[model samples]
Target: MRQRSSAEHRDLCALAPELSESLVAWWEVHGRKDPALKPWMFRADGRWPAPEEALDPYGIWIAEVMLQQTQLAVVLPYWRRWMEVLPTVEALAAASLDQVRLQWQGLGYYSRARRLHDAAQTLETQRWPRSLEGWTALPGIGRTTAASILSSVFNDPLPILDGNVKRVLARLKAHPRPPARDDALFWSWSEALLDPLRPRDFNQALMDLGATVCTPRQPSCTLCPWRLHCVAYAAGDPNRWPVTDASKPLPFQVIGVGVVVNAAGEVLIDQRLEEGLLGGMWEFPGGKQEVGEAIEATIARELREELAIEVQVGEQLIALDHAYSHKKLRFVVHLCRWIAGEPKPLASQQVCWVKPQSLSDYPFPAANARMIAALIDHLRADTLSQLS
Candidate 1:
């Protein structure tokens, strides 16, 4: 752990008690209490439970994992749907990976779902972890996630350093560098400030403070509980703290997608290999377009190479851009007529031909989901024309 100056540590210690008290008091009134938004935190009466009441650890685990790199509003529906289906560890362990992926369809980070499934299976054979080390041992349960779950469930007094807490801490102390640079220092600060008796509420308050008041942009310092003691607020530039590293432009690639339809009117889709990006998800046959290759030609070539089938690429179905965390992709999709060779999974897990409407039965990446909608619309239009 990176050590801060002795004077800095002394100052942090001096204000830790008051900071925790003020934040927790503020949170009781302003913290997220909506039953619809936080079903895990409320009772049947749609009110917060008594402080001594226990929360569902399983639900807390699921929400924390889903909240990683995803916002709360977007995660609410998915979390509710997931809980409806696989409400317990045993249910999740028993569910197939395909079913799990289906539940996590629109969630961009597919690996998190996979890891949760794996962890659940592991837990099915053993007891739920009670300690920080025990929880961290589970797949995809990092220190912060493990701590958050433990503190929320067991009141373990384990401080969290999630994105929200990091920003809050960085601004509170007027950090000179990006919070990512000295994780140890931030963790130390978080630990020092944690309210041991009210670890659960204190941690929740810290995250809420950052998300609502000490926000990354245009923070409402006047509304902040710690504004009087916050270093950055005193400096008159809260946003200027938590300095960010320069970002590089994401590399862009043009993908050529072939929506090959057989004479029987079934479209070809394949499951990606259970490795690498978007693993285990189904997608239309496609590959990156090489330099100087016409998009149509690229589509035909990709179909041949990927599925071991030839196709006559035709009119464009849709052209859409999708950005992932690391890179950006522009998918150029086109309608195609299958020409030769039996469709085989040459570079994928498997290939199958299904009615366009049946495409919904499979789990696809977000971009491919858009393509399916377009394809379905196109097919519906064509059917109406023929009927007329």
Candidate 2:
């Protein structure tokens, strides 16, 4: 653990109580309290429940998991829909993986959904974990997530070190190093500042302060409750405190995607292997465009290699770009006519033939979803022209 000076430690201890109190007071007035949007935060009387009053653990778990790498506004509808559909751990565990993935469509980071389902299944067989170790034992539940869920649902005094809180802490102390470099220090800081009596509200208020006021860029320092004490604010550059590592350019790859249609007017799709990026999700069969290969050849080659089927690559249907956190992809989609051989999942977990309309039943990556929409429109136009 990186060590701070004795004087700095003393200063932090001295400020902890006042800091927690001020933030909690600000939170009482400005914390997220929308009953309709976040029903778990309120009681039947539509008031913020007391700290000792435990909220729905399942709801808190789902919300925290969804909020991982996703913003609050983006997660709101998804969280609401998930709660309505699954409602309980039993429902989520009993539901098919396909159903779970469908609910998580367009949410990105499909792994979170899969892990949530797995954890739900585990929870169905057991009881809700009360300790940090038990929660972290589950798939996808990291220290921060477990702490957030525990604090929110049980009013545990555990602290969270999420992205928002990290930024807040970094600015508060004007820490010169990136938070990632010394996360232990940040964790300690979070613990020191946490209000043991009302952790639920205190943690939420801290997150709200970061999300709304102490933002990543162009923070509203004037409105921030902690501005008076923020070291970064005193330095006249709050944004500079959370020093970031130099970023490497995201590698870009050109992918040739094949939309294979047979004489029966069914399109061939495949389920990716149940691991790695976009794992267990359905997508059009394709592969990276190799050096010195034509886009159409790439499509034909990928289909042959991945699905063990031959295809006559036809006119381009669409070409689109999609970016992940670590990579960028240009998917050059072409309509293909299934030429020969029974399709087999040589690289994927499974392959299926279905009408384009049925494609909606399967969860596809966002880029592939767009391709499906285009394929449907194209097919619809073809049918209309034939009828005319």
Steric clashes per prediction: 0, 0
lDDT of 1 at 349: 97
lDDT of 1 by residue, 1-388 (tens): 2355456667998999988899899998988756777787665576665556667789999999998888788999999999999999999999999899999999888989899999998898997799999999998889999999988777777999999899988888888788898888889889999998888888888888877888879999999899888899999878797889988999999999999999899999999998899989999999999999999999988888878888898999999999999999999999999999999999999999999988988999999999999998898899999999
Q: What is the C-alpha lDDT of each candidate?
A: 0.89, 0.90
Compared with the true structure, model 2 gives a TM-score of 0.96
Compose the digit string of candidate 2's lDDT tens values, residues 192-244: 89999999888889888988888888999998788788889999878786989
Per-prediction CA RMSD (Å): 1.7, 1.5
Q: Which pairs clash in the backbone of model 1? A: none
Model 1 — which ten-residue stretch has the worst lDDT? 1-10
Q: The CA-based lDDT of model 1 is what?
A: 0.89
Please report the candidate that would top lDDT against the real structure: 2
| lDDT, residue 163, model 1 | 91
How far does residue 158 in candidate 1 sit from its true spot (Å)?
0.7
Off by over 4 Å in 1: 1-5, 43-51
